[model samples]
Target: MFSSTIQVSVFVFVTALIGFLTYLSCRGQNRSSQNQNREYFLAGGGLAWYFVAGSITLTNLSTDQLVGMNGNQMALLALWEFSAVVGLFVLAKVFLPVYYKFKCTTTTELLEQRYHDKHIRAVISALFFLGSALIFCPAVIYSGSLFMQSMFGVDLPLMYIAVTFVVVGALYAIFGGLRAVAVSDTYSGVLLLTMAVLVVILALQAIDYNFDGIPVERLTLIGDNDSPIPWHTLLTGMIFIQMFYWGTNQVITQRAMAAPSLKEAQKGVFAAAGIRLLIVPAIIVIPGIVSYKLFGDIGDSAYGKIVATVLPDWLSGVFAAAMAAAVLTTFNSNLNSATALYVCDIHESYVNKTPNVPKLSGYVTVLLCLVSLALIPVYQQADSIINLIQQLYGLLSMPILSVFIVGLLFRNVHANAAIGSVLFGVALYSAMSFEFSPMYAPFGLHYIHLMFVTLIACVSFALISNKVIFNQKAEFSLALYKEEEAK
Candidate 1:
């Protein structure tokens, strides 16, 4: 082990560099009312292509994927990243053009415009907020701190570390808004992804360029239905999960919405797809499997323990900064989106029509940080971070994806009919997942395949509801989705 002085010096240097970059990017943005809604919530609608790409990649790249996927301990987990490419392509080619045309502040705004109803917007927005406050934000903090504690061997209490992350991550969200969150994400994303690649290389070296000791199932592409990622589920549910996440989820799509122009945003989305194809697959899988070789079935501790084992003593500090960056990016990104949903969908709609948005956002950010922080202990009980995430969202993701699918595909489906699908979806998926509470997973299908069942049921019921209950109105026309211009 290195001297405490050396560790302190390296850690301080790395964090200071991160601070400098953040200040540099957000220096000129101030808290003016006209600019508040624009700059704070949407980065003044002026984010460039590179920043857009970096923010998008980093927002999703944190411990949720890194620690959680690695915790699964298999190369098959790489398919999650691989499937995301198709999702990004859809976002760029299918969704980006329409979003830019409407100038939406959040993903739900597009839902409202598409259906010509604010209620539809509010429902989806509420789902986004609930998902963030209850599940996404807390899980990020929990999983990230778990990794940090394992890697650094911090002597502090786990709750103390969780609260510390909240304070730091909250500052990034409350002080800067989307501009601050997006810029910091891009700046730190570079260092974080680079260091992750280095870990992959070092992990291979630690194993002496061999995979013989690792289990065959861990290295294989095909997973049984009982595996965390079943191969059959990939053909059915994986694509939709990626689409809902990358294309429609407010936390991620918020970054895409903040771009300067449609062309630039498309470039960013495309660029992120390219990065996922190569870099992300390694970043998520190799280190965990390598840790299997070195440490033997450590579960979630694999990532932190592997990083600690493989990197040089001095580089550990830099890696710490990178991990902190990843943690903060995902945490702050959710906080910003949570604030946006409240202000745009709830507060402005009900509290005050012309409220001081900056002040309101600040208030919302603090409240959300506290709520999310309080939920950290809940996540602490999870068996597998990634599996917990999928299980939690299983109740919402497919159903939400159905809303977009029905709204975008069927022109005659009115706003009221759309709401029925969303409500049904939420209720239906919850019942199916929680059937184990009072029942069992209706006929033994895996949750992933069950997602397909849920989607089809939502769509079919929506169509029937539109025809019988609401009397299909041509309220939203198919022609609204124009061919987005080529870059």
Candidate 2:
């Protein structure tokens, strides 16, 4: 049976209404000026804590978290959810302070400072773009959009609406810039949180009210002993997932920098982290588990079927809308950051030092759209969505985080040391990647391994090289003077 058209229409209308408000909020800004460039690029240093919190939360919560992570949780069923908690806390504590202290636009910028080298900056920035473009954004978009189109019978003509959503999001960033992205994220945050809570509540009620009540085992984190995803994989793999997500990814950190102040930035990071900690179990893991419990079997194809079949009419529609928003917010944020790197870091930094802002933003928007369209084919080629995201994150984070930690923590780190650490980090990560990620351990120590490897390598290189290659001027006075002047 089809979903109630009325409920579906209402859900669609509400989301559209939110989008309209976001557009209007962006209207007050100078959409086509050089002075507006930084604001358009960075939200003008005026990002409210609410939008910062919202955008960060929304960006993190996507089809990757929804479908891919949910799938992982159901596979491991217990240990994975706990890792989610760990990831949230790490983001709240470790990376948040470093980001705020430096006032970084890109995570790589922080690396450049610590390493005292432009090469380090350029390398990390490139990794972020490659990760988002080739892996993160496309996988989520194709999976989420395809799931909705198939579930709702949204034919090809109507299905293009999904592409329109991406285009609109790009324009929002291109024209209105970061301010617009922030406002749109606020709308997405409220809707995503409310809808997730609602779905969880409805699911709990459905389970409680249906049959002879929900089974106690369904509530347990460990589903069955025979599953391939044992607690071992869940715990170890989760450490990698969490640390990379919270500590390294720039799309998430971009919002942190946009916070009104350092205190607000901390609060926003903590708040968003807290919300994400709860959201994964509620909307993703719990529902997937419940669906398996009720339906008795849940293969990869069974996810969408379970949602439509189980939930009430209105709620199902709402779930559809929420999924759409999750994918859009995530894709939008990634695209915006990717363009910012292209415009601010690559074009403005090197090729055309004094390029016009409006024209550059416009050009970057067009380039990203083409790249995204090309990536759609790559997304179609991928089989395991989760694996794709993980692999991408793997290649991106290790090299970049190595450069960043050198910049922030290792004051004596030379440019060559920084650059050398990155080359080594990338080489090691690439070699260890498809394997067991020897970086991931059996104990909780697993999550910190990559961070440890990256940190140790950079710091060691910096220290060893400091005696010979120290830039006394850049280190003692010149860099200090530059930092003072930047302030």
Candidate 3:
């Protein structure tokens, strides 16, 4: 009983310390800028490279990656992290220049500029908002709550813990805006990364660095046909998946875009890529594999259980604090970005153009928080949260990527044609995923491969629809290509 008290004390101390440090870092920023949107949402373009790197890293790192990837208990899951390195590079090299050139406030703003249509921007932003509110927000809360419950062996109801996260995270997004979210992410990231590495080392030690009893498939990086990630799919859909996520996803890209210059943002992204390649992969997968040896097929509980088993009472509290901070930082990051999408993309375009930035964001943040909390029960039934998120994200990801591809690669394409192609891609991927069609079944194609196919179809549909249905000739352009080469 005394041990539990010590653990709780350490957790509170560490969590509060990180918060105080974040407060110190973000204090005295000019909140009353002429462009209030830029000041509030983009941090007035003042974030240095280190904060940009830290925010990008921790915003993506969260308990979802820790709990969900480890839940699989295999080395193959490391491929996700490996591929993400390539994704980050793509963000830095390919996407950042265009974003800088356009001076985009949101990623979808680039689409509006390219296609000359505000409606398409609103449509895509609505999809991003829905994807965040429906999938990411609830999934992060559910997985984080589960990790806490398993780590502390707490008997409290999951919903009770979830509500706590939602409230605290909402406060961060509401009060500090992106500046506080990014600062807190960087601070939490250092603690989380250090403790996660310790957990990995200790986890391996607990098992005496043995893998004799684990199956070959579990230890192998090359996934077979029936595995969750088939080897062939890596060649087909994996690169594009990384491109879409790191290049275009508003939540991740917003950090890079907030930097004062494109070069600074690219530097931050490259640093994040280095971390993904080196540190993230091992920490995410190794502990879970070790847990299988110790606990035997525990699923998502493997990570928290392993941490509790390996660490003593007080250290477990520190790790718990790191994890809870991870949950809050990630939650608020998404809340901030989702509110950015609504305020910049939806509400500003549709409602009052000069609505109060903080006031309107406060209302949207609360609405999103309520919706995310209400959806926690839906994610509770998932067998693997990470895999489930990847699969479900196909409903939006490829279709959205296709729009960017069309907008960036070609000229004279009608905005409605791109929108039509998005709807088509969604329907096609949904039918294939839900087994409404047996077209892919004969070849035993994985859903990842299906995503690639969906992307190609969407791009083709957009181009063809432009010429035939909309009676506008879509011309392939090397203008941006030449401009990028000159740079």
Candidate 4:
């Protein structure tokens, strides 16, 4: 490790550049005075392919994935990033067009249009907001701060680092909006990928370019039944997981939603897919693998530890800046999306139809960041940040995804039926995942398998209740949905 002066100087210089570039990137966006909500929330619906690609990748790439996946210290974790390509493809081909057809400001708004039920839209948007506040926002800050502390060996209090992350993220979301976040994220995304590749190279060289010393199981992509990612789960649940996250999640999908045209948006997602295939696996898993070789089973600290151990001092500061940018990318994305949900779903719909959207959005962003800061301690107690995320996702993903599935697949599933399906899916998944006595992971099935059970069960419930309970007339027509979209 180099002297403290070098680390301090490099960190300051790199971070200053991050600020200057962010300001420069968002300057054009600030001057646009039209449709405040569209300009601020959705970047005036003007993102091109490259911005879409960069923003999506960075928003998803933070130390949460790096630390959390590497925390498992297994190559099997590459499945998470690799499988995301499928999710992006599905988003582009299947989901993105529908979103464009409807011209939704928020992803959950599509549910309202689909079912002609504002209540369901509110419920889903609330769920997205809750997930962001409780799970995503906190996890990103905590993990990024953890990585920073490990890399710099800083003596500062954890909350100080947490506050800095929260403030920077809030500024981007509050003032700069989606345009600002996307621009900064794109630049950081490129730098992060480049620096991460360097880490892999240096790590390999550190180990004398030999693989024999690394544990075979750590290097193997095939995960055993007990492994963090079982091989079978990839087939059973991974695809749906990817779709729910990339295709439907507000934080990630909002970037693609901001594109000015369907073609531009689609190209952005395609670029992300290419990056995922080539750059992500190398950066996300290789460092952790090298960490495992150097220091046995350090878990979540593996990424930070490996970066600190392998890179030169100047490079460490540079990577730290990239890491900060990654953390902020996720944070800013979540904040922007959360604010969008509130303004569109709750504030405009319920509180004030004529409210100043930009003003309200900024206020909401600040409040949410504080709440997220308060929740960081909850994540600090967790044994593994990624596992906690997956477990929590168990409660939300399949059930939420089912709502989209029913709406898109069956023209005749009534609003009440869709409601029942979503509610039942949530309840059943909760019971099985939390192991509430007799309802536990039915027949000793894995949670992912239980997701399949819950999705099928929910669909059945919706269809059954529509036919039997409500005796609702079944009508099959794309025209009904298109009518809403055209509005």
RMSD of each: 1.9, 5.0, 1.4, 2.3
C-alpha TM-score for every candidate: 0.96, 0.81, 0.98, 0.95
Residue-level lDDT for 151 in candidate 3: 83
Q: Highest TM-score: which candidate? A: 3
lDDT of 3 by residue, 391-445 (tens): 8999999999999999999999999999999999998888787666665343667
Score candidate 4 by lDDT. Answer: 0.85
Ranking by TM-score: 3, 1, 4, 2
lDDT of 4 at 158: 84
Ranking by lDDT, best first? Answer: 3, 4, 1, 2
Clashes of 4: 1
Off by over 4 Å in 1: 30-32, 435-439, 473-478, 483-487
* Model 4 per-residue lDDT at 110: 86
lDDT of each: 0.84, 0.64, 0.91, 0.85
Task: Looking at model 2, report the run of 10 residues with the lowest lDDT sum.
Answer: 478-487
List, residue by residue over 1-487, the lDDT tens digit for candidate 4.
Answer: 3466777777778777877897886775544555666787888887889999999999999989988988887788898888999999999988888898888888888888888888888888888999998899999999999999888898998889999999988988887889889989998888888998999899889888777777777888887877777788888888998999999999988999899888889999999999999989888888888888889888898888888888887677788888998999899999999998988888888888767777888888888888988998899999989989988977788888888887876665577787777888888888888855578777777777778787778878887888998887556555533443321
Best lDDT among the predictions, by candidate number = 3
Compute the lDDT of residue 86 as modeled in candidate 1.
98
